[model samples]
Target: MAVSRETEPPAGAAELFGETWTQAQRYADLLSTWGVDRGMIGPREVPRLWDRHLLNCVVVTPRLPQGVTVADVGTGAGLPGLVWAIARPDIQMTLVEPLLRRVSFLEEVVADLGLENVVISRSRAEDQAGQFDVVTARAVAALDKLTTWCWPLVAPGGVLLAMKGRSAPEEVEAARPMLRRLGVSDVRIETYGDLAVPTTVVELTR
Candidate 1:
């Protein structure tokens, strides 16, 4: 439905809906309507997106630098990208999804949210200009291939964050050579939350 009744506060463990429960309900309705209209989510997937998808994305989002520009590669349905935009309104975002249909869905979501600083690019992540401070992808492809696909879109001194299920240490090691080849040298992992399958955030830096 609406946005989550949740947000990680500056100094607290976490807060239930930064604003209010009613506001959360409103956001839930907004997102559900948008998801339904754009076909970004199916009727059954709504609950999952609200919990495991959207909330999961925002839960780990505080890990990033505030107000930084970010791009979401292979943003199929704009989970973390759109969720990030909603959580941190000041952070500029580009959702780079090569599929025109998905880009169209992103466009609708941006318009519905009235997000002024967001854009949808119909191009592969690697082909885009290296302009964003952070590049992110959520369960898009295998970590090894995804590393090569998204690393080039990151600005130097910036980072690429891969949101994954289960541990990606082996994937990170497997992707090390690809990372080095793509100029993403330092690879590290940060795991967080009590997910049934833990969420691992793979950070790639130059």
Candidate 2:
């Protein structure tokens, strides 16, 4: 089946991804073909895969501190996590996922791309031990619940980059009590990229 109306990478994709553009393209191909066949990605998402999925994730790579350990909680189909690993080989990326089917797809793509910077952990975020310099999630859960699961994985002086939608402010406000209880005072809403609707990230520092 045809993935999307726009199968080609959108304009500026190469420049944005820089040296890793080729790997990014290969990853996109996998997402369009095998990813869809395995039900990891919805058929409707194929058309806008480059713009909505790849670009949305890649745009936020600059925020990650250099050469730090990063974990992407519930990184289904490798959204920002795999994208970030492709773009920045400097950082160590751990794609934390619980589903077996998704894990299989991620392993295949990671090997096919020859991405040595990535590690696939087939476990839920809450069950995982150890901490990372930065922890992030996309469409995983609300801010409050996300904290409960992801916060423990964030090391001291680390940050949780929760990619949210237009309702980021509302989610942040609703999670205020939980945030304070967790001793999280440094919460900020930051926008990244020059897209029409920029990526909204709720940065919760630990």
Candidate 3:
């Protein structure tokens, strides 16, 4: 089918996605094609889409409480948001994006996948109303600024899972004062999966 820079799914894709493996493939195709064309994903990302993007996001799905509502703030191209929705049908997913172009792309992807559990919110994180069981963001911003924006949307007793890279611990330390002010003492860095570059997530419970 001549997918643009098509890459094979990683060894554990099927294991991670289970019965939704096909849907995940379709989503990958979209990300490789439409997602790149629309500037949602870079062309350089296509070849490693599975490992760096898809798998990186799905591995964190186990952290989500079953059937809980999750909001992915600034979900550009639906990284962890749409990816999580595709992998976990049991939970409700909201992909919150401010840009209309991205929102349009997300809407098309949701409709194309017939994903009934996903919702597209055309608003920025700060403007988004209501709280959710989990509020998440990936490559959105640094811990301090990100927490400032996402903490409000996390319902009391809920959590904010910030997908970070190697700087997670440093970011946590830098944001300590802000985190303490938010009444968030239960913060930890959790790594998921057995991959060489496992996904690192900063989990903060409010």
Candidate 4:
């Protein structure tokens, strides 16, 4: 599945991505091809891989503090995990997925892209030890369950940046009790990217 020029970065991409724009394009192409064939992404998703996936994932980069250790939980095909690694070389990223197939694919992509800052962990978030400065997830689970799984991996004063949809606020409301019990000090909803297609993120600080 070759990437179409129409799906390439938008006009302001270079300004936002700088020299990494070309690398991001290559990553997009790889996702469209290997990502679909491996069943990590649907065939219909191929056409919008650049905007719907890669760009949407990279938009979260700005919210992260510099030089942090990041854990991407349930990283199916490495959404913001691999994408963030491509966008911000300063961060060390750990891609955590339980499925062997997805882990294999992530390992291959990491090797193929020569992403030294990224590591593949074939384990679920609950089984994984060690804390990270930032924990990221996309389409992983509901806010309540997600926090249960990911919160343990967040270091003291670290944060969990969950890429959510329009129901972010509602999820926060429903997860309020869990947040309080888990010692979450702060929570907020932030929107990023173009107005036409923004990415909603729920941030929880521990």
Candidate 5:
């Protein structure tokens, strides 16, 4: 599958992404190659790497607080994690993935992007120690399972930002009991980007 460059960044992306837009484009190219070679991403996904993957990930930038530490759980091929690092240089991003191949890919991408604020960890969320201001994941698991894996990594007063699909409301309702049990102080669903295909995020505050 050939990677397509026909897809440009969404309007106003240059102002939002600033100098990092070029780096994001390079990262998208890498994802088309390394992400597919290692089976982390499907060949069919190459065409949508810009809008569906990179831009979708970057849309979450406005929601993040400045200079916070973020632990991206199950960061396969560094989806939103690496993209976030590229878009926001102030935050410290840890791309956590258990598989060696994914870890290697993430490490190389980090180096290739020269992202000094990024770190790649080959470990599951539950096994990882230390908490972060923001714990994030994209397409990793369902809401209930995601809570189990990610909640522990959220520091006191921190938040878990799980990038969900159209099922964001349903998942929040389904996970209400678990959220209560886990002492989640608040829960809300936020939508970002185009209204037609906005990115839905389930925000769980601890």
Candidate 6:
């Protein structure tokens, strides 16, 4: 990892989120800036970008395999994928979104950040193959559906760093049959409360 500063978020949040709210805020600002430019959101709603978007994405970052290549499936505004790319920069990332408008925003962000390790793909994750070490899905689907869409993209020994809610355990239980068939095991949960929307990181190793 490149040497990085310990820019912690607001006090309590640092405990839960591991970054200063300022960092999340900056991410929000960037997202909002793009949202406004694209007309995806009104200016007023931009202020809530941190609460509604950035924080939601950051909560899932900790679950990713450190320094591994990652793919963000259904990267609608490039949440954890874009944020993680900005945060780590050490990990190579592919941000896949089917929407052209969002892809335009992602392209702008990547260019603005000079992110050498990132690529914005205007395609479905399932449509691409053998290009990533880790796969990520944030609020993308029920575990069963998510696996069907994303698990195949992960290489053996890699994982799916998926986000889930409070009922994650049950989601995992419900996804067991599919998980087994997909050659995935070791479903683990990681919690983050610093986000305005609390989340659970549900990891499945392939």
Q: Which candidate gets the maximum lDDT versus the true structure?
A: 2
Tens digit per residue, CA lDDT, model 6, 1-206: 33222222343433433434344445556656656767755566554555555566665666666788899998777777877776665689998898898888878777766678888788887687665788888877899999889987978888888877788999989999998887776888877755545767888877
Please provide, for model 3 over 1-206, each residue's C-alpha lDDT reduced to its tens digit, 9 standing for 90 to 100: 43457768978789999999999999999988898889998888998999898999999998898999999999999989998998899999888999999999999999999999998999988999899999999999999999999999999989999999999999999999998988889999999987779999999998
Error of 5 at 38 (Å): 2.4
Global lDDT of each candidate: 0.72, 0.93, 0.92, 0.88, 0.86, 0.72
Given candidate 3, what's the lDDT at residue 65? 89
TM-score, cand. 1 vs. native: 0.81
RMSD of each: 4.9, 1.3, 2.0, 2.2, 1.7, 6.9
**What TM-score, computed on C-alpha atoms, does each candidate reach?**
0.81, 0.97, 0.97, 0.94, 0.94, 0.79
Clashes of 3: 0
Among all windows of ten consecutive residues in candidate 3, which has the lowest summed lDDT?
A: 1-10
TM-score of 6: 0.79
Candidate 5, residue 46: lDDT: 77
Clashing pairs in model 5, backbone N/Cα/C closer than 3 A: none
Better of 2 and 5 by lDDT: 2
Each candidate structure's count of clashing pairs: 9, 1, 0, 0, 0, 6
Report the lDDT tens digits of candidate 1 across residue range 1-206.
55442322232213523533333344456556665666766656654545567567767767778789999898878767877776676788888888887787778667765777788889987688757899999978988898777766778889888998665877877777777677666778887655554467998885
Clashes of 2: 1
Clashing pairs in 2: 4-47
Runs with alpha carbons beyond 4 Å of true place in candidate 4: 1-7
- lDDT for model 4 comes to 0.88
Model 2 global lDDT (CA atoms, 0 to 1): 0.93
Candidate 3 local distance difference test against the native = 0.92
